[model samples]
Target: MRVYPEQLARQLNPLTPCYLIFGDDPWLVETSKAQICAAAKQQGFEEKVQLTQETGFNWHELQQEWQAMSLFASRRIIELTLPQAKPGTEGSQTLQSLLQQPNPDMLLIIQGPKLASEQTNSKWFKSLDSQGVYVPCITPEGPQFQRWLDARIKHFGLRLQADARAMLFALYEGNLLAADQAMQLLQLLSPEQPIGADELGHYFEDQSRFSVFQLTDALLGNKQDKAQHMLAQLHGEGTAMPILLWSLFKELTLLLQLKSAQAQGTGLNSLWSKHRIWDKRKPLYQAALERLTLPQIEHMLATASKLELMLKQQGVEDWTALSHLCLLFDPKAHKHLAHIELY
Candidate 1:
């Protein structure tokens, strides 16, 4: 069963037999896993919470465990976590086989990041689709994210003005985890009071890391210096490079898509509502669409891919490559220098 992230809360049932929870967002992945575990326990499968890491574990061990009859209970929930399931790895092979013949008594929950290209079409993926549910905990976008935020505020019986919601949306850039934390902080800082954008700005005044909002502002304003500085700081602070890349890539990709949609005669308002684009992101998207052509966006994505490859192959010194890429967007710099020599 294929399911969207928004429908997850309603679709997830305690009696579901299996779940394949995978995505780029760690927060989404964790939340889905937690929900599944809680639901399973509620269904009297608490003792069957089997956790297994993919690394170093024998593939046969999982099969054996799954095949074994549940002595303690009539049903069980098996959670298999693959933290490092790179392509062509033994873990992937094991998962392939396990997906082929899932145990009836066990509700297997496979949790991990984006599936590798090869794994997406593998026998395991297909098997999971046919036999169980495949719920992608992808990052929320546009209106979905705003709705999520509003629900979060309402959950605590707090009220936020529309402008305040827009401010939070801009500040977090659809990063649910950060948005959730910020909301919690605001609740603590101003309980029972309606929050305005000014309150948010004042609260975040001294905070470092500028957040994704600042990154977008700098990029759109052609302030390459600030953009590079922010990137360096995020990298230096040991933030996962892939996660940052994903965020940036997602923004660019969405802009490119919106640009195409606009060209096809779709109204901005309709597109925004359809894609769930938040109000705060409308200006940023418009700016990006005007500034970067489709070819440029595609090239940037390619450059990002190459950068990721370099980082994985050559390690930390790849920051130089990133810095060079940043120079491509510098308004004062010669555009000719944008050409990157691939290794």
Candidate 2:
């Protein structure tokens, strides 16, 4: 029973005894939970109990509290927050056991950070999904962010000039929380005010964020545009050039190992196992292997060495060199790199 946030207004499973909401975006996760809670309140589930998983959390307390609610014949919603989204062995057993004792009077809501692919298959997670509604709230990316921004603007009861909207997209592209806060400020300052491009600078600061892992993953997965944009964002955020170079160099070294091994009649699985590559990340490596040859990978590694040497000797951070190095991952962009002066 998986339900998306957008479909909650009409297709919300109000009759379910449990709801599991999880995501990296707090706004989306909180919004979905509030909607479910409101629906539960309408169905006489007026009593609410909130529990946050902290250090030395007692799993037994949950069972005891539910029993207390059942004993009083009172409908209740137990809102449990697992910050790390991890339930150890005992906690896992406790949740599974609770599923066996279905209480019509109790509505359980478990909210947490996004679960990894492997975490979703746990016994407790399976049990909860089998009997409850699972809503995964994910942050929008690329053009999806544009739609989300438009919807959010409408929801805030404000209109934006075309250039003003684009400016917000540029300023808060990767950071949703900051974007939401910016919207709140705008709504508070002048409800229903039509924001102009010039007003955007007065009201908001640049809050875009990108991680090195995101850029590397995008490059390996052949998402050239996203990787390019993330690189620019990282540079703008003042990420150390040495750190960025090291990450790219690491990926290049790994790819070189794979390409060299595969060329010498070695199986990819053996190399992957030796490298400790996670199953989910194997596809990204495979994409890189298919796109690049042994010589090309080796050339990129040599290029990285030159950039590292140049940075240490001259103390000049050459972002163009880094961009050219990244762009080489894309066969189409490889030719374009010749035009850029690399150090």
Candidate 3:
């Protein structure tokens, strides 16, 4: 009943009736949730009903939705997002009842923040364990992060020099989302180019010509005007929009994580060590963390994701989408623009 995040992809074919994915790492949690949803869709679970544990949320609605038939969709996926992982007495009874009579027409997905040891051993959890799959999404740290980075780079069909690997590890050690984004940017900026410390440093830290890395740092520092200029420079250089969007969204994701950690009382020094942030870059992260709240950072990320989808799926103009995303970080742009639309 217990499965690792990586293993869930292969396990999706003979889809289980229920899935319980819990973890603290937002990146990992989101990745696993997306993969499961994708697999469900591939298996013809087209209709999705999402339920979140918010104040005034009626738990009975879940049962009603489960029992209802969709006129269009043959099968459906019911997603319950328990942000706090505390399914109350009513929720627990509902879960127990659902498991007692598993639905064949709907796939139930329970997602939440990490669970405590005691909570995991509860009767409700045991019911999930016996009947479905439980996946724990933990962020890798230390050497584990190193391996994750290496694998991620290779997965992107790219190779990195040894020193470049170390440099990337130092820059994006604890943050998988950023590391992955960095790789994607690299692929776009220099397709088929070897990844080395110099290659990474050229864009990330050095005085290279206007580059994606520089734009990322500018966004992190919340230098709106500077970001706009660099974005213009990159666009002028014929840089691809997907790569630019990837870099911006990646930085926003890291900022959101750091902001969340700081809000949760994690010290700057501890974060630095945990994330292997270097001396020069610490101030940028610190400033961004202080300037942006978790909600604002999340909103930026959501907006960037929307732009990416628009460019890829809806065939929107690449420069238009990238320009709109750049505006999200620019104060001046905000004053001029009426409002940003998100999909």
Q: Which candidate number would show the highest lDDT if scored against the true structure?
A: 2
lDDT by residue (tens digit), candidate 3, 39-120: 8888789898989989987889988988888889589999999988888889888888886776787999999988898779
Using lDDT as the yardstick, the better of models 2 and 3 is 2
The true-versus-predicted C-alpha distance at residue 150 of model 3, in Å, is 1.5
Q: Ten-residue segment with the worst summed lDDT in candidate 2? A: 334-343
> In model 3, where do residues sit more than 4 Å from their true spots?
205-343
- Residue-wise lDDT of candidate 1 within 1-343, one digit each (tens)? 7776656766566445568888887678887777777877666675554555744667767777777777776777777776643424555566666656645567778777777667667766775667667777766655676777777888767678888877776566446777767778877988888888887788763213445545655675566866786776667667676666666667667767887887788878888888787787678667667666666766766777888887777774466666665555443343665564756
For residue 61, give model 1's deviation from the true position in Å.
Answer: 0.9
Q: Write the per-residue lDDT of candidate 2 for residues 1-343, one digit (tens) a residue.
A: 7887877667454568788898987778888888988888788788888998899999889989777745456589899998988988988998899979978888889999888877789999999989988888887776888988888898898788999998899788767888988998999987877889898898776687778987899999888777888898899888999999889988999898888889899999899889989997999999999988777787778888889989999887888778888888986765666345455
The TM-scores, one per candidate, come to 0.60, 0.75, 0.59
**Where does model 1 exceed 4 Å of error?**
49-55, 86-104, 141-144, 188-191, 205-343
Error of 1 at 302 (Å): 20
What lDDT does model 3 reach? Answer: 0.78
**Candidate 3, poorest ten consecutive residues by summed lDDT:** 202-211
**Reference-based lDDT, residue 332, model 3:** 45
The 0-to-1 C-alpha lDDT of every candidate, in the order given, reads: 0.68, 0.84, 0.78
